[model samples]
Each structure stands twice: as structure tokens, then as C-alpha cells.
Target chain A: MDTAVLAGEIMQRSGAETYRVEDTMSHIMRKSHATRIETSAFTTMLLVSLQEEGRQPLTVVRRVHKRGMNLDRIVHVNEISRKLCGDSLSLEEAYAELKAIEQESQKLYRPITYQAATLLTVIGFAVFFGGTWLDIIGGGIVGAVLVGINLLGKKLRFNNVFQDISASIGIALMGIILKQYVFWNMNLETVIISGIMPLVPGIAITNAVRDTLMGDYLSGAARILEAFMQAAAVAVGIGVGIVIASALIGEKVLL
Target chain B: MILKIIGVFIAIVAYSVIIETPRRFLWLSGLVSAVGGAVFVVCNEAWRMDMVLASFWSALGIALLSHIFARAFRAPVTLFLVAGILPTVPGAGMYRTVYYLILGDASMSSFYLTQTLEVAGVIALAIFLMDSVSRIFLKRDVGTQPWTKERNMDKKQEEK
Candidate 1:
């Protein structure tokens, strides 16, 4: 609830060096102590931080804070703890910071649900290289449908399983458009790659790999498995459409 | 040739940075990606090393650079991993894959499989090896996280 307590939670999640936690705590303490800042409050602070810092890369700031070995602003933060904290503070640790924010009991924009639907429709056209009116209109519809689902999930407070399933199905439906409408000219690979861009396992896999390298074997393995599952889910979404197309055409769906 | 390698490396690094990777290893990953491709190409063409060996060496080089970058940056291995591996995605090979698929040449099936797997393998290899090795020398100094002692203590109890 207080700054020190808040600092610990941050440390646990972000794996920041002790000093970094203390610095954040001190900063927050100097500012607010209501256990969690409102979304607007946090965003306001972040904007101020960003503006004052002149748009530096987030990671650069982190790295500088990391090398400050003289940084432990608290006790019981012996060398071992300090080392672990340092280990956790890496860029991969960025996730930890995010986790902290999410746990703040206060959140940002309401997932911008409608925005997602709009994005999907726009992306659909981008996938198709649309110059024709039909192309633009179709992409808009798809995007709208996609965003509709995103909003639906938020409204219903759907769990991860439900979200994943709907997203997968939504993607397949788009694939149907790719097939039935565009047919022979659909640029299947590009469509698949671009549509599944959000599902790309780059970040998860990289983190898993990093965790393992850092000797956090248990965490690493868990993360790697998580990454694979995410990727497999993406593949399945595409594979289903491919299989369906193959069945309809009596030819192996090479996409 | 040198510029090409550097260009690829720069591309990979730029991608990572734009997507919000840690700055500490951005340059390092870029260097690795560029150099890794160059090394493979050079070894394959000039030294006449077996293609497999040349690629292996390249992967090894990139992986090593990635690992060291991870350590120095006090970040995770992926910043380095993506930066190191993206350059080697085998766009050319994939082009060939598409061509062969369109051409319906069954023999090129293995070629497609081989090249596709190679690219994936390089990426996997970089991440897997980097993950495995990063553990040996992990740093944990996070800059901003919910790191209050009481909160972590409570979390430990919940986990148990």
C-alpha cells in the first residue's frame, strides 16, 4: 500500500534491481500513496516521464539503472538478492513491469474494443492490396467483425480460452474470404503471415530463450511451452482453413 | 558484400528496436545478424566449407553474440535472438519454396522442407541456446516493477 510495499511488488514482478525499485517507490511516494494510481494518473506520470526524458528508448533507461551497482536503497537486499534482482531487470523484465501495471487494480482504456474491429477491417484490405471499391468495402467489413468480437470479449469478460477460440475462428472466417472471394489470386502466404502477425511467437520465444540462458530453467521452460502453444494456435487457425479449402477443391491446401 | 551484411543486421536491429526491444543489445543483435549472414555466405563461397558447417558456424556466432549481449544489457536473450535471427529468415529460400510449390515439382519438396526448416532452426537455435546459456549468467536488476518486499512475500505464500 505504501511506497516500500509497492516497490516490493514491482521488484517481484519486474525483477528490477533493488535500487530501481527504491527509485520508483521514492518517486511514487513523493507523488501518491493510494496503493494504485488511476489509469489516467499513471498515464499522466508516464507522459511526464517520457516528455522530460525526451523520448529515449525505454530499454536504454533500464540499462542505465541496471549498471548502478551502488543502487540498493533497502536492507535485506544482500548480494544474492541484488544479483537476482539484477537478473530479473533485463529487457525481458519489461513484461514484469507490465504485469505490475496490470495488477494495479486500475487499468487503462477499456481495451479500445471498437478500435480493434476497425483495425482488423483496415488490415484485411492491406492484406489484399486493394485498389478496387469492393476490396476496400470487404476489408472494412472484416475489420468491423473482428473488432466486434474483441468488444464482445471485453463485454462478456471472456476468459483466455474463449478469446483464443473466437480469435482463431475469426481468423478462419477471414481465410474463407481469402479463398472464396479472392480464390486463385488471394496471396495466401501473405494473408496468413499478416493476419497472424499478432500471434507471432517472437517475444514469447525470445523471453523463454533468455530465461533459460539466465539459468531460470523452470521459468524458461514454462515460457517456451507457452510460446509454442501460442504459435500452434496460430498455425491451427490457418491450417483449418487450408484443410477446408483442400477438402472443397480435392487438392492439398498448400497455403 | 560487407554493406549487405551490415544492412541485414541493421534491418533486424531496427525491427527489434521499433518493436520496443532493450537498447542495450540493439546494436549487438544488429551486428550479429549482419555478421552471421556474411560469415555463412563467405564461408560457404570462399572457404568451400560444407554448407551445413558454414551455417552451423554462423548460427553459433550469432548465438554467442546474442548471449553476450544479453549479459551486457542486463536484459533477456530475445532482443539479441530476434535481432540475430531475423536476418537469416531465408527470404530467398522461401521464394524458392513458393516457386516450387507453384511449379508442382515433388522433388523440390525436400528443398522446401530443408530450407524452411533451416530458417526456423536458425531462429530456434539462437533462442534455445541463448536461453540455455543465459541462465548461467543471468542478471536481475529491473528498473521499474512491482517489487515491494511485502508484495513478493505475499506472492510466495500464494504460490506455495
Candidate 2:
């Protein structure tokens, strides 16, 4: 029971789909010869109950928070569940592996690599969008500023919405400055769009649609709303930044 | 077009790193994204297809590849889908929608808004279609149905 709960919690926190979470938990519980196993996973809640022909039932309800994208954890947990279902892994071994995954949750790549990824993503998308050399250079600098702001946001413990907003505002300001002084012919649209690619909710939106298609309405609705909130935050931030920067520069450079 | 494809491949690989995908699978994920990017480019530029249709085809290719890679590598489909779907996500459309709204250009805002929603819907359709197709070809239902007595009996027989 503990193993199943831990596995579900790990998967949920790592941003597995609700159906996948429930399926994995049910599979894990079935190994114990539970006559009735019920596992239901919502966006923010996970519940697994098992009742045999015994005197009592076992139920675990874990309120999951702090969801993030960690595909490695999802793959690992899925593998563990498959092994457990195949009877190759004992319950204790599965539990221990899950605990290790949970404990090593903070084991992301180095901070420097994350910053480099942000930089490369912006530059690559800028080029993909058909930016010229000037646009690519300008996008690279904006990407650098974005990474700096992101690191600072982490240090200051900014909320997700605020972090996106600030990063976007910084992008807009940088784009305007580059257009005004540095890269005169640079495409502001291309640079800003590429810079904000890292902040967009592509994964969230996809997962939301998938969940809805899979008939998990609650999680789907919640995720769709979350994605909208994130998009709105980014839009509002860019609008405000463009307004502020254009006002400072004494012209209407962008909408 | 070649440059664009390379750029998209690099972008997708970097995105996989940010999302903490398993390092061992990054190259495969990038290849899937590159294939989608190539399809989109051919449809949009060479064939002069509508942007929405191009996005649909691109997403369809990515979803198909993701499902195949999942089966081949024994990994979750989300690993590839989450990273490979980046190129067609309509970020520029979403930006334009709100940008026009802020400028009080209600017509343009609504125009881009409709386009953005259309792209999103079509991407969803593509993923759904691929998912159903894969399920049809695979063994047994892979959904969240509870275990049945028949399945248990089969397992016991196999053990015997």
C-alpha cells in the first residue's frame, strides 16, 4: 500500500497524466491480491484504496502540489511499475526505488546548463523563424537577459506567473533597445517571440487536450485554465513592457 | 529550409534538457522534432499550404513518431510528445492575439484568436487520431480499465 501510494505521488508530482497515475497505482495494488482496488487521480489529488476480504481497507489520499515537468521521473516510475506488475521487482525494492526518485527530485542538470539551454533555445527558434544575423544576435542578448532574470527570480522565489511576466517584460524591453540602437533592421517580432518560447505553456496545453480526450475532465479543465493563465500573464507583461519602453523612447514601436 | 530544420532540431533538444528528459533519449527526441519541422516547412513553404493545415500535418507526424518511439524504446509517449510538439505550438499567434487586443484592434485580435484556437484544436485532433490508430494496431486495450477475472486467470495459467 505504501509503495503504491509513493509511486503515485512521485508520478503525479512529476506531471504524469491523471489516467496514467491511476493506472499505475491500480496495477501496483493488484500485486497484493487486493480484491477491490480503486485509484483515482485528479490534477491536485491522488487517492488509492484497496479492500480485500479482510476486516479493514487501506486508503491513501495524498494532496499533490508543486507539479513540474520531469519526464525522466515519469519514465523511471513507469518502468518500475511495469517491473512490479511483471513480478520481477519485489514490493520493498519498488518502494525503495520510488523513495530514491522522490529524494533525488532536485537532481536537475547544472544551473549553467539550464542557462545555456535557455540561450540556445532562443537563438535556435529565432533562426528557425527566419531571422537574419542581426535578429539572431539581438535574440541571443535578449535570451541572456531572460536567463539572468530567471536566475534572479529563482533566488527571490517569485511565483510562476510573476516570473513569466518579468521575463517577458525584460524581453520586450531588450528587443526595443536592440531595435532602437543596436540592430536597426532586426525584426522585433521574431526576436521577442523566440525569446518567449521558453516561457510558453506548450506542454501544459498539449497535456490538457490529451487529458480531456482521455475523459479526465477535471484535470483537463484545470490544466487548460492553467495554460490560459500563463499565456495571459506573458501577454500582459509584453504589453506593459512595450508600453513602458516605447513611452521612454518617445514613439509607438510596438503594440 | 535546411537552416530552419537544423534550428528547430537544436531548439527541441535544448527544450528536452530544460524539461529534464532522460539524457540518453535526447537525440531521438530531437530527430522526431526535426522530422516534424521538415514536414511543416515543406507544407508551408514549398507546397504553400495554409498555416493551420501545415500545423495539423506537422503535429500528426510528431504524434505518430512519438507513439512509435514509445513502443520502440519502452518509454512513455509524453517524453517525445512534450518536446517534439514545440515547433507547431502557435506561440506567435497567441502573442499576436493579445498584442492586437492591447492596441484596441479588436478585429485583428479576434482574427488571431480564432487562428490560435484553430491551431490548438487541430493539434489536438492530430494527437487523438494518432492515439486511436496506435491503439487499434496494438495488443489489447492500453487504457485505464480495471483488471478482469479473465486477465487474472490468464496470468495464473501462464504461471502454471
Candidate 3:
């Protein structure tokens, strides 16, 4: 098709702003046909396109800004001429749409809570280590508490990774105390699992393996590398604990 | 039975909450997890009953079920894997191997390597069998295979 028609089609399909419609079209034109677009403009346009394609947005966002000039001021004289002749979206509908958009964005931005994670991890460890049913159940309860505290910490805008690491260490100390003071042979597995459960990259490693087997060489390698890095992070935490415990107590105190 | 079911429930709840799935589909996921755990329980008992036959049958069963779940859920294969594979993941086995290393129990590195390979082989076999059945029966044709001219067109787009 001709350039103008292509521009119009891309604009309609992508929901590109009237002003940016021409620029994005030119960008697409300059790139090879095989090139996949990754620009923010293209991504926004693509999301809009998906909406136009009848896919309901699982989340939505709406933003209004004072750009220091009105649309009528910046718009073309001919566009103003058309606006005088025609009408468009109602203000109320725009506001409603924006509200939905904000809700969607909030959902996407929600971080994983550590409450349920820690409790479940501890319970898993207890049960797997053959702890009594009560001990196992107690571990689950602890995990729930950890998840709750984690969520609260996030809501309070606390440090992200630091909160996580501290909570994990806190849970570990609880386990150690219970073992040392309460149950002489208490299960450490529950504590360790609960504490480190969130950091395990099990799914990532599994997908990496599956992708490699299926010959998705590029995606596979990328995922596999990510899996190892996450694994290394978990290992480093363990190593650091061991090193610190060794120096302070002069014994293997990180049981 | 109920206790085992509870363990399975815990697994599913833990995975979903940990993975951040919404509450809507969690019940469905829980039921699926319970079923997965029960399957492993049977498989484990059977393996104890007869190692050779049970291993063959269990491997075959897991492959069939895995492919079915992958197609039905339209979820990534990893989800089914995390749920179903856990019962058989040999986490305890790995821990034992780790403990042996920490305690310096014999020249255990080679032994642990063998154990690791055994675990790897089982996983590899399960995946291969699942993929093959998927190709043969379902003919779902994942991977880079070109089933038709139109499908091949998609590859042409991706290759660039």
C-alpha cells in the first residue's frame, strides 16, 4: 500500500496519538520488515492495538497532565477546523477509563508478599523432614505471618531486598531458637525452607531446561543463564551466613 | 489420605500465593495439585512394589499426564512440572547428597554425581517421552516445525 494508507492503518491499529501517528509510521518504514519493534512508542501503540483487537485489558491506566498548552493550541489549524465541525469522547467516559487503567497498573506493580511464602516454606521443610503433623502445621502458620509482615513492609515503602533478607534471617533465628530452646531435635529443614523458599529459582531452571530441550536456543540460553544467576544469589546468601558464623562463634553455628 | 491431601493443598496454595496468582483460579489449581500428589503416592508405592516395571509405567504415565495438562491448561509446561514433579523431585535425595559432602562422607563426589545423573536422566526421559507423544498423538507441533505454508510464514517473521 501507499505510505499515507500504511500510516493511517498503523495509526488506527496501534491507537497512536494523532500527532505521533506519522512519526511511528516513518520509524517502522526505516526498519527492516523482519525487525521486531521495541521502542516505548511502539510498545504503547502495540498495547493499544491489542485493545482495539477486542482483547479486554486485564489492567488499565489513565493519566492526565498539564502540558502548559491546550490541545487546541498545539493542534493544526485544520484539526481545529475539524474539531469545530465534529465531536469526540465525553469527559466522564475518559475519567472512567483512566480509573480502570490505574487499577490495572496497580495490580501489575504489586510485589509478591512473603507472608504465605515463609509459612509454606517452613511447613514444607517440617513435613518433608518428617516432623510431627503439629510441627508441620506450625511451620505453615509461621510462613503466613512472614508473608503478612512482608506485605506490610512493602506497603510502608520499606527497602525491598533488605526487608526480604531480614525477614528470612528473622525466621531462621526463630527456627534456631525453637530448636535450641524448645525442641532439642527440632527440624531445621522447616526453617531453612521457609526462609529461603522465595529465593528458589525452580520454575526458572525448569523452563530453562525445557526451552533448551525444545531447541529454542536463544531463549533457552537466556533463561538458563538467568536461572544460574538466581541460584548463585541464593548460594551466596548461604555462603555469607557460613562465613560470618565461622568467624563469630569459631564453630559451625549456622545449623 | 486426608493428611496427604492437606500436604498437596499446602503445596498448591504455597505455589499460587508465592507465584502471585489471583484468588479466582486457586481452587481449581488446588484440586489439580491434590490429584497430582495422589498420582505420585501411587507411583511411589508401585516403585517399591516392583522397581523396574513401576519405573517404566510411572515414567510413561507422567509423560502422558504432563502433555495432557500442558495442552488443557494452556499454561507453561513448568507449572504442571512444579506441581506434579515435586512429589518425585528427590529433594531429600539431593539433601542427602549434600549432607554427605558436608560431612566428608567417603569419596562421595563421584557417587553424588551418579545420583545427579540418575535424577537428570529421569527428568530428561519424562520430557522426551512427553514431547514425542505430543507430536505423535496431539500433533500440536510446538518447536520450530513447519506444518503448513501459513505456519511457516510465522517462522519467517520470527527468524528475522
Best by DockQ: 2
lDDT by residue for model 1 (A87-129), tens: 4433234334434543655222234532652354245323322
- Order of models, best DockQ first: 2, 3, 1
Local lDDT at B91 for model 1: 33
Which stretches in model 1 have alpha-carbon errors above 4 Å? A1-148, A158-162, A182-184, A243-255, B1-120, B127-160
lDDT of 2 by residue, B1-160 (tens): 9999999999989989999998999999999999999999999999999999999999999999998888777788888998999899888987788678767899999999999889988988998898778867753535222244237645875696
Q: Which scores better on lDDT, 2 or 3? A: 2
**Model 3: docking quality category:** incorrect
> Per-residue lDDT for B69-101 in model 3, tens only?
655644333334544444444343333344344
**TM-score-based ranking, best first?**
2, 3, 1
Please say which candidate is ahead in TM-score: 1 or 3: 3
Judged by lDDT, which candidate is best? 2
Q: Give the TM-score of candidate 1.
A: 0.45
The 10-residue segment of model 2 chain B with minimum total lDDT is B141-150
Share of the reference A-B contacts seen in candidate 2:
0.69
Q: In candidate 2, how many Å is residue A85 off?
A: 1.6
lDDT (0-100) at residue B42 of candidate 3? 60
What C-alpha lDDT, on a 0 to 100 scale, does residue B78 get in candidate 1? 40
The DockQ-derived docking category for candidate 1 is incorrect
